[model samples]
Target chain A: MTASDDFAWEPLDDVDDLEVGDRRELSLASGKLVLVMRTETGLHASCADCPHQDTPLAEGMLDGSVLTCPLHFWQWDVTTGEPLGVAELPLEIFELKQEDGRWWIGMRR
Target chain B: MIEVTVEDRAGGRTRFAARPGERLLHAGLAAGLGLPYECATGTCGSCRATVTEGDVGSLWADAPGRRVCRRPGEILMCQSAAAGGALSLKLPTAFRDRREPECRSLSGRLSSFRRFTAEIGTFSVELDEPVEHLPGQFALISAPGVEGPRAYSMTGNPSTEPRLDFLARLSGPGKLTPRLFSNALEGREVEVFGPLGRAALRPEDDRPFVAIAGGSGVAGMLSIVEAALARGHFDRHPSRLVFGLRSMEGSYLLDRLSEFVRLSGGLFRTTVAFSDEAPDPEFEAIFPDLEFTTGYVHDVVRSGLSSISADRPICFVAGPPPMVDATMRMLVVEGKVSPAEIRFDRFG
Candidate 1:
């Protein structure tokens, strides 16, 4: 594993607990972040607060790969971390993986 | 010099210097900081920030954004100036780690003034240099002698040249419109600062577009539609535009809208909704290709929601606050559309 002082791989929760197209807020030791969407494609994670105006992303609307910020309607591609129309910046994406039927997130040190 | 320290929610800090009598938002943006703002003229509360440990002064104390700032330390960054010493503040939003188009001040001259009605007019500004702005973006224009600048959306397509078109609606006498409409004001120099506003059309958006505008609010929509047509967006995805007016006399831009519809080759749909009066026979005769309905604009949109697909659809709404609010509520609550799917610019 590549060593980095900024990030670490931390187990989040059981993969079976999260349903497809549903997002859950996970409180890790590092900080509060949102585990956005388990689709047939894969799992993804991003900051809980929106990059625009700091609205909670947990309150945002998620449709498949697109996550829409509730505050300003700024849309993001959850998988690629690309901002869509009206969104100026991409959402910070965390590395996510599944092992032993449990999900893990890359948390910033 | 005033030292402004802004702390974001994620604990990121940005320090900048602000000159005396400079708006905090302006100074921050000039320094290439991603400060939150929407109507830099003190209308929208998007730029509200909290002063943690310093005194701040206001250029416009009674700004509309004040009503939305409920917290004790909260102040509209657009209206607030650092009065003295080092100022520490907290932002609800954080600056992103990305490159953004540089926004700067531009000088221009007013030309091509044509009155559409007693309450409405269309005009053009010839800039000293061409500006790059997205469709649905707006510019802030200040008349030579005016005390404050007003935000006006650029009408028609985004231009690569120095010329820009605008639609102006007279709220009443004794404002910027009077000065602009004056006969002697032609060819007068004006100061412009912008390429502002985020409710814009992106080239990458492939979803069907629905535009809802009221009166002068249609200004930005015209630019959006024009850009959409140029991109052949209508050819792939359908577009529906609904414009609302009080009566036929107050109506303008029907011919331009008709032209857009004709160019879309049956892919674009448009409707004119009149709130107070029924459609006149003579008005229908002029634009035979357009559809006319009698009702409030939001109601027309609500009634027609069934025909529009919700899958990845992008909707834009602009108008007076009440109309925009009503339309937003209908789209969110009644229509069950995701709030993210709807975009709006509310003029109070």
Candidate 2:
């Protein structure tokens, strides 16, 4: 399938008040950061960068609520973004939201 | 370098020049000889051969292949380089057509790089050549930024030429897969050495065939099913494919597998086991023909096939070390499938 080109922005009310199962993306020092709550889809998200070989997490699999590396099936839990089920190391999950239809993410603050 | 002569069971001998430090299987392959091997790094015992004459020594004492070598003269071709000169070895000698398939350096552009699950991607390489590989066999793939060559079994049948399909898993310490998919761009060239590996579907064995696979290992088993359907092997005996994954989403071949029931007129059956999650009803709705269970893969296989007392059936298994080892142990210890009938294709 071809990649999606359409972009949709949703606004979220509060960042700290966000409950489980909510996801948002915000800009940070590095770049655009994505934050996903583990309970929503029962999947974990990390830097989208494969830690072992630097593959994107976008190409991986999620099983047992764990995010498996698409390249080798190394796995991590989506809820905590902590590596689990197999392999080692945790994935970085950014805090995010949709504010007034605009996707806003939390940086360090 | 040590030179040796390999003799087939029929007394046909082929001379091979072995490298001093290279694994015997590597040397044989380099000498343009087809040597039986699965995980050429010494995990699978497919490369086991008997030393008919001369001395042989293993490079690694703790090599896992050592477990399958029983005969006084048996040694692992992947682990044992020739220690002395003028060696005579007896090939495992199966009834495979001696005309080995041509191996080509296939260059391709990676396309359709999408994640099948969290850790696996179902990708295809549009190859420059038409490569034919039997089910249960694999190809040696080389991609940019990945160290050395890594092997992956073809999920598509040999009939699909010029476009080879494969499923790759991303894990820490795994080679190549992560680098290839990460920062992906279109029109990048990837090299492939293919149509290699010997484990394949056996049309002659009329007994019920059993396939047990774990994770991406389902790639070859799925190909085996396709081959069986093409060759009418399923008409004679019902094929049972037992696949194990951590979740329903982690399993990639279920789309094709769903048609097994109708395609084989209910003769072919597929059972999937998830290690982590319970069966999803939606998944069952999509593939009503398949059976879903929550447990280890082998446990499901053992329970599901217990009633059938058929003998001399063909069993094909591929996966990680622990899963493969567990299945092999159960098949040997409980199922009592003869060693000759049990096939393994583990890379680790």
Candidate 3:
């Protein structure tokens, strides 16, 4: 409602206690899994599955701003969704914002 | 025999012939096409390909790697056999050229067996034909009473004597290792298919390096260290190894690693990180050159990378999957090292 009809922001009420270097997977209304994490920089959102394979990114390791898949050690920049290390594909990213200390993630409606 | 054709990401194709029940992955690799694989024994799922034409049959229906083969036509190339007259598959890799000394199948004899701990042991495979493999490669060992082949990294390189050394941790009774450690079975014939794994140490990789290992995972790191010592590479660079064990009771390769530290003239150093117990004073006296610390391997490396002399040192890591993951995160995230500088193979 804050933006246009093409984009809708959903309240992520479960991530109230997420700390730096912590990641959690959230189930969307469309049955898609979204990965939410807090890095040293800020909170970021991406598809919970690695783009190389469907390995859950919530089980992966987050170092600073980089996210690494535990399966094959393929890495990506959490903020830019750009491929790093052995990854050949970019991660699917979503816009995450905070208001009044709470978080809301924007998805294509 | 039927034609087995493999297509890569760039649409380049390579063809080889395989028999009805032969693994097309082995055929492609033996034919000198760099078919991608890690543990060639139905694990890691790196050799997965889509069957675009003809057909293939699964040799192992319950392979754990099958988790990756979700599509109807997708198959694990290492666990599948040719079933039809002509077969075609597509790989996700851009055609990786086969490096020198492509793998082949051969028979070897067990010799020079010895035990370090009650559950851990080592021996040499005296091959009928000498296999020249790079440091850090592994081979699959299949003995008569064992269910299937188990992969073990080469702890030492092939010498003029035509022997390859390996270490094995016991998996309990009725397992492959109980026999491997219980006897000195020289001239015991066994099947070996390898020179597999991509963590091989290359002279061109880096002068300064850091090797971290846990438990029996030190075998591969030991091979790399020996190679560096043999080729005089240890003389020029300041490299370090931090090996993790539960306690001094689980330690192995003390003589060799300690000697490497002593001979390197301060260029190479080793730290034994004990997770379960504090550094023992008795061991401190025995290994004067080695530094002992009380911490996990990842945590130990984070606190101190002793003798590491370069900002961009190549890193070699091994152990269980969880250990490798934790260490990799620390290296790339906190240490600011690029992933391109790290080399390792995934294993169960």
In order, the B-chain TM-scores come to 0.93, 0.76, 0.93
Model 1 chain A poorest ten-residue lDDT run: A31-40
Enumerate residue pairs that collide in model 1: none
**lDDT (CA) per prediction:** 0.81, 0.68, 0.82
Winning model by lDDT: 3
What C-alpha lDDT, on a 0 to 100 scale, does residue B80 get in candidate 3? 93
Tens digits of per-residue lDDT, candidate 1, B60-158, equal 888866875777898999888999999998987666542335567789999998988887888888999998888888888888777767878899787
lDDT of 2 at B316: 88
RMSD of 2: 20.5
How far residue B240's Cα lies from its native spot in candidate 1, in Å, is 1.1
Q: For residues A1-109, write the lDDT of model 3, one tens digit per residue.
A: 4464566878777887899989999987667689998988888899999755578988888888888887777889999899897786788899887889878778888
Model 1 interface DockQ: 0.10
Every model's DockQ: 0.10, 0.01, 0.43
Better of 2 and 3 by lDDT: 3
Cα displacement (Å) at residue B98, model 1? 7.1
What is the C-alpha RMSD, rounded to one decimal, of candidate 3?
A: 3.4
- Please list the residue runs of candidate 1 whose C-alpha ends up more than 4 Å from where it truly belongs after superposition: A1-109, B70-72, B96-100, B172-174, B309-311
